[model samples]
Target: MVPQEAYRPDAGAMTTAIHVRGLTKRYGDVQAVGGLDLEIQKGEVFAILGPNGAGKSTTVEILEGYRKRDSGEVRVLGIDPQKPTREWRAKLGIVLQTANDAAELTVRETIRHFAAYYPMARDPEEVIAKVGLTEKADVRIRKLSGGQRRRVDVALGVIGNPELLFLDEPTTGFDPEARRQFWDLIKGLAAEGTTIVLTTHYLDEAEALAKRVAVIARGRIVAAGDPATLGGRATAKAKVTWADGLVETDTPTRTVLELSRRYDGEVPGLAITRPTLEDIYLTLIEAPE
Candidate 1:
């Protein structure tokens, strides 16, 4: 797995969707956060990738104003998260790693209840439809399967018409098909300008949805950038191979032309390959902390 890295937008006085500096959190002798810094732009889909107990949750919770940080400066929507107001809280939505156990209330009922907490809530039924729970809107939450229940959680999270959404391992237990469907829903939300912050162990999920990604390890950002270019992958040489020879080069087009001339036509079995997200992720995570 690729070890963790984080986003480094720029350093200066400018407002961003999320801004953090020197963030730290500790529990007794254990430090959960160690002088971390981050920056996320508005309308951006950002992912925070890490393994279990890598301080991903702690960082996110502090951003949501649910956990107190020992020290740092945090601004979400240009307002300090540590001093959150009711309006500020309403603008943020969260889908936790684990949803609360469902009760007898139907999906529609649960969503409506949560919606009422915000001043400007999206239509409950509309949100339900968006999450692909329209057919099960009236089904009791207790009767839904795990994937269905997760859809309901998503429905409730977006029902508040939040400006920013936090998804912490949102698709944890989903099957492949369900995961794809959920990805579409998230894409739709981002298309409409909802800033999303996701934390997931699934490298594929992060690469697919996030515009930028940060990998965390040992309570600090180990890597951060465009997933395609992070850790020098964008500039990383591709292996140009054929039946007869293998070479690594950045200028594959030029190499291919030469090979074609020498081969008297197309280079047989010509292929250019670069490191995949999974390969980079494993190397990063397995590195010394």
Candidate 2:
């Protein structure tokens, strides 16, 4: 695991890594992206959350210069993605939702092969260790498990030592342990000043990695803020439940105190709950756009 110090950024420094204004995209009559505006800071891990066909992929593709937008101003790493240069492309690392790799190549060979493309690539052996693939380094790609293969995809993504990384559903097939390991790698990278943008269906993953989150729906961002407080979650009413009853109120602390007193210091089966990230995400996506 990466040391905790790596996650700390320079004190009070906020730089813009990605900027978008009046972004729009359409296919036939369907609007894929509609006037979406977003700004992500340097060295930040930002997550985009939304259901299928919600335009999350469309927006990301445009930002990556893989797709064209109908209208908008977009600047990634201080350059317009539409006019990508070799230097501009070199600074980016992208891990798509799915990729086709050379099935016959060993993990070590694959990493080495891709590393040659970057002028300042990381050491292949070190990259292998970072992604927890040292044991499978010599194994052919075709022989690895689904989750293990996913790790290779990540290894390739960070091999170039990119300044900005784009991860689309990065942990798709990872097991519980593997997922945790991947999170460590991401936190370590963020600590080292690599700006990361992530899109995932896992709310827990977003809460664990992203300092800020944006929820997209119907081709527009319906909500965006700190994951802990999105959609007024921070101040939403808490539910205090005990042995025989439950009460929803603004001050759960007061309710608990009264219950403790009434129960002579110990309330049976007492539980206090507030809106969780998943709860807020579901609510936001379901609301009318």
Candidate 3:
């Protein structure tokens, strides 16, 4: 049942899917989250990147209503998760690293069972097919491969027909093909107006799936923006490389032109490159505390 006061999208909370300001959470002497701020729009695929213990878990848990925040404002779907209501919870889906251990049940049985809990669930068969589990729909959960099980987790996550989805390393056990398939599924979900909040260690996955990303370091956001240009990667020095050596320069075009004139055509083994998301990620994670 949708709560009139809580479930209205136009409740005048500034119209953001998820919003946070100065969020802080502490555990004794260790501050798990310190002054974090985030804003995710409707239908946006937002990714969070951080090293281990970088407050992603704490921050996200607070937002999900699984943990209490020590201070600051937090809102999800125009409702304060801190004081979550059934209607607010019904609008959200969470796909964690762990899944149900109902090994004896078949995939169809599991999905159908989970779907029963939501008032507005998607068709169980359609959910299974969307997660690439159609071939294994009748297979026992225990009989499935790790990747296939992960797909099941995804299926269960979205079966509710949620307005927002939290994906914590959703493709952990996926093979290359499975991972690509999952990405497509996520893209499809986003295209249909699902706001996805994703947390993953895989930089390429973040770059591929996220429209915007926030890099958390030392319990705070260090850098956030378009994945291609995060941390000034787009304007960062480019390296021109050849068989002999490599040189870093601001004007890679000019350097390439000089090298081209020097070689009179293709500079042997020549390549011009800028920092990749992974490169910038490494730097962001390794920055001095």
Candidate 4:
């Protein structure tokens, strides 16, 4: 695993995959997005996090060409999404938060149907296998478990062999083990050089899958950086706790050593912790504009 600190914005000479400048959208009196600017590098797994009505959904929809933006420049895969061509659309894949309407088609049949839409599609059976649905390839969509049907959703998304994939809460209803399996599948896709844009409410999911994350609130980005370092979290003071005492300090190691010496051995119930990604996210979103 790459260390979290290694995900700095300027770590490499990266190519741009998606770029937006001064993006804005308004819904009557409420501004859904306001002057948002972002850039995602090729092959990077980037996450956008926010509560409902924070404009993340609007931003993502604009990038996906599902919604029109009022103003600002936007480019996805080097083409303006506003004027997307058939060829450009073919290069993208999307896995929405909700699964497609419950289908009667079997896994293999569904994959094959979507494969026909792309110019260079992966083999249907191969796509099914890639999503760990080989055993369920012959099963009808309505017959599979929730997690199994989710795997079918993923198979359809990837069958197009897209250069970029947008996953919107891909594991929303998944159990722990199922979520882990999904993460592995996503990692495999990222390793194959597919740029991924993920939107998830689960902070741990963002931390596990995204190299970098942007926190949006009230239609603006309040924080954007490596997940570990967002909102200065990486440098935040650690809280050192023991059986009867606790102290917050920049030098947690020194505090632990002192506690050990005072106790003449290991400190009882000793623990050290920094602010988690969730902790930082809460602060960012709840802060005043």
By lDDT, the best candidate is 2
Q: Tens-digit lDDT track for model 4 on 1-289?
A: 9887776533432478888989999999999999999989999999999999999989999999999999998888878888989998899998877765647888888888899999999999888888889988888898998888888878877889999999988898899999999999999999999999999999999999999999989998999999989999989999999999999999999999899999999899999999999999999999997
Better model by lDDT: candidate 2 vs candidate 4: 2
Model 3 compared with the native: what TM-score? 0.92
lDDT value for model 1: 0.88
- The alpha-carbon lDDT assigned to residue 164 of candidate 4 equals 94
Tens digits of per-residue lDDT, candidate 2, 1-289, equal 9787765532212377898999999999999899999989888899999999999999999999999889988988888889999888888999888876789999999999999999899999999999999999999999999888888888899999999999999998788998998899999999999999999999999999999999999999999999999999999999999999999999999999999889999999999999899999999999985
Ranking by lDDT: 2, 4, 3, 1
**What is residue 27's positional error in candidate 1, in angstroms?**
2.3
The runs of at least 3 residues in candidate 2 whose Cα sits more than 4 Å from the true structure, single-residue gaps closed, are 1-14
| lDDT (Cα, tens digit) per residue for candidate 3, span 1-80 | 87787855475555589989999988999998899999898889999999989999888888889999999988899889
Q: Candidate 3: where are CA atoms >4 Å away?
A: 1-14
lDDT by candidate, in order shown = 0.88, 0.92, 0.90, 0.91
Q: For residues 120-153, what per-residue lDDT tens digits would candidate 1 score against the true structure?
A: 9999878888888889888899899999988887
Model 1 off-target regions past 4 Å? 1-15, 242-246, 253-270
**Maximum-TM-score candidate:** 3
Structural similarity to truth (TM-score) of each candidate: 0.87, 0.92, 0.92, 0.92
**Tell me, what's the RMSD of every candidate?**
6.8, 6.9, 4.1, 6.4
